[model samples]
Target chain A: MNKLCQSIRFVAPFLLAICCIACSNDKKLPFYGQREARITKAADGTEKVDTVYQTIPPFRLLNQDSIYITQDAFKNKIYVADFFFTSCSTICPTMHRNLKTIFDAYKNNPDVMFLSHTIDFKYDKPSVLKKYGQKLGVDGPKWQFVYGTKEEIYHIAEHDYLVAVQEDQSAKDGYIHQGWLVLVDKHKRMRGAYDGTKSDQVAQLQKDIAILLKEEN
Target chain B: MRKIVLFLVMSTVIVTLIYSCQDAEQLEYQTYYSNGQTLYQTYCQNCHGEKGEGLGLLTPPLTDSLFLKNNRTVLACIIKNGATTPVTVHGKTYEEKMPAFPKLADIDIAQIIVYVTNSFGNKMGMYPYADINKDLKSCATR
Candidate 1:
């Protein structure tokens, strides 16, 4: 009886160790928890506050084809939107590069889309935007380059989406705006915004979009 | 017989506990991008290649030793505040102009750099984001 008890004790611990290792490496918890949390938080290190929307504003603009466009064109689609000018000498290139990633990812998903709004309506006429789109290699139809009146574009940029867009004549190029990508749901509510230049933030944007897509419609 | 069995059981339990109690190395593993890989795919892969190898005839490769060792300063500067002149990497000259990444915060640059360095077989030691932040001031302002 004593020998049996000793053997049982010895085997029990070995089994427990194996069990612990197995549990620690469980496939279900594949990602590190700390990293996941960081991705889910805000840049200021606080938890992100989700914005609820009651209505989406309406506006008119020109598409890359020189056709008249409006908010109604998006009707019921989930779209990712951002503001940039064709000749922007700063963050615009990086924004285009980053957005290309999102464009490629959902290029086949007919329901998902991209809207690149030009802050330089004067320069970014359909022809200019079409050429710029060619340079960036934007997948046609999946991504639309939009141009509208400076006043209306600036108004929507600042008030509606809360993005910064201004004409800064003092600064060499006479334009200024942060590089931001806003994700809007089917209902036209702002679900999230991402730093178009940073891949990690964009990835978080992708994840948030996925989350938003999964939400009950 | 019972005494032998008990001895064996106790030995097994001790061995298990001893092995399990070993402490893990205290290396600090930063959670980069957390979503960095995904973000890289979305924003950087188009120009930098899906793996930092640089797009052919368009951009220079980051993973190449020529650029990594020679132009670390210029590279850091260019990323923060776009590049103008044609630069060389791996002994070959690259003429493609890379635009600046000004909208990117200090942390974002760090994460992208780390992602590029570690991935695509670049393997530059994991530099802290703070270092990038310090370097960015001189690069962008100048």
Candidate 2:
């Protein structure tokens, strides 16, 4: 009886482990930011409660190619977005370095896209962003380096993307911002935010992107 | 008995001298290499990357032994006092401005030079930190 109990204890954990992995495989990414629930009546006269997720707002900004872009460009695609500038000497390099790995992995995929917004409005104009993108060896429309007025960028960063940004003269790089690589889904809702500096988190972002792509299907 | 004692004393002195001569230098190199790795991660790894591959053409890779060898004199200056001019490495020209590390002391620069030159497939030997004083002079004159 004791032998049977010992074997059961050993086998039970393996069973539980397999069960957890199975459950995790079917897990879905959660919607972030403020969500509202509403009651609606269907055409068949049935009342149903619906979830209205907060999404990215519409705005016009100049891309690295010096062309103005809008939400129409990302109508059918999901994108990963971050804020940085050409001359930032801090976490931006590491962040972009990690993001570039993801960019390369999904370079040919139509569903995946990457966007970077410059918080240093005074220095990183469209032309400067163009040079920076070329130097980083990332160009083309798959990955976009965008520029905009300080007010437009900062307001969207704080409210829509849930990332923080600020201009400070006392900071070492003349600006300060978070290093979140936010993942947005096809529905324009934020699904995840990963710290761009951490390789492990970026790896998770890669896996989550795959999972999100599958969920879309 | 006196002769045997003298022989033993002479052998001990010779062995101690040989060990100190060879082993001390090896120990010093090892110390510098390891310490420089820590310093590299803290200061240089961000732009140059973990493998010294560098980011596109934005920053020049440290893996080019020829460039490192030819530019050895100005390396110390470049580290302590940033560089604005374009530098060509591995047949590519990088014009981005490298930020300065004014806070790194002479010894720190030495250890970093030792680490960078030794690692990333380049086996250039120890560049003692004190040697940076001369590099600084050449740098200032230029």
> What TM-score between 0 and 1 does chain B of candidate 1 receive?
0.69
All candidates' TM-scores? 0.51, 0.91
Off by over 4 Å in 1: A1-54, B1-142
Candidate 2, A1-217: lDDT as tens digits = 9999999999999999999999888769999999999999999999999999999989899998889999888888999999998898888999999999999899889999999999999989999998888888887888888999999999989999999999999987899999999999999999999999999999999999999999998
Interface RMSD score of each model: 5.3, 0.8
Over B6-111, each residue of candidate 1 has an lDDT whose tens digit, in order, gives 9999999999777656422112223563445665665566567665765433456667855565555555577667777877676656664566667777677666
Candidate 1 iRMSD, 1 decimal: 5.3
Once fitted onto the true fold, the runs of candidate 2 whose alpha carbons sit more than 4 angstroms away are: A1-25, B1-13
Candidate that would win on DockQ = 2
DockQ of 2: 0.75
Weakest ten-residue segment in model 1 chain A by summed lDDT: A28-37
Sorted into a CAPRI-style docking class, model 1 comes out as: incorrect
Clash totals in order: 12, 0
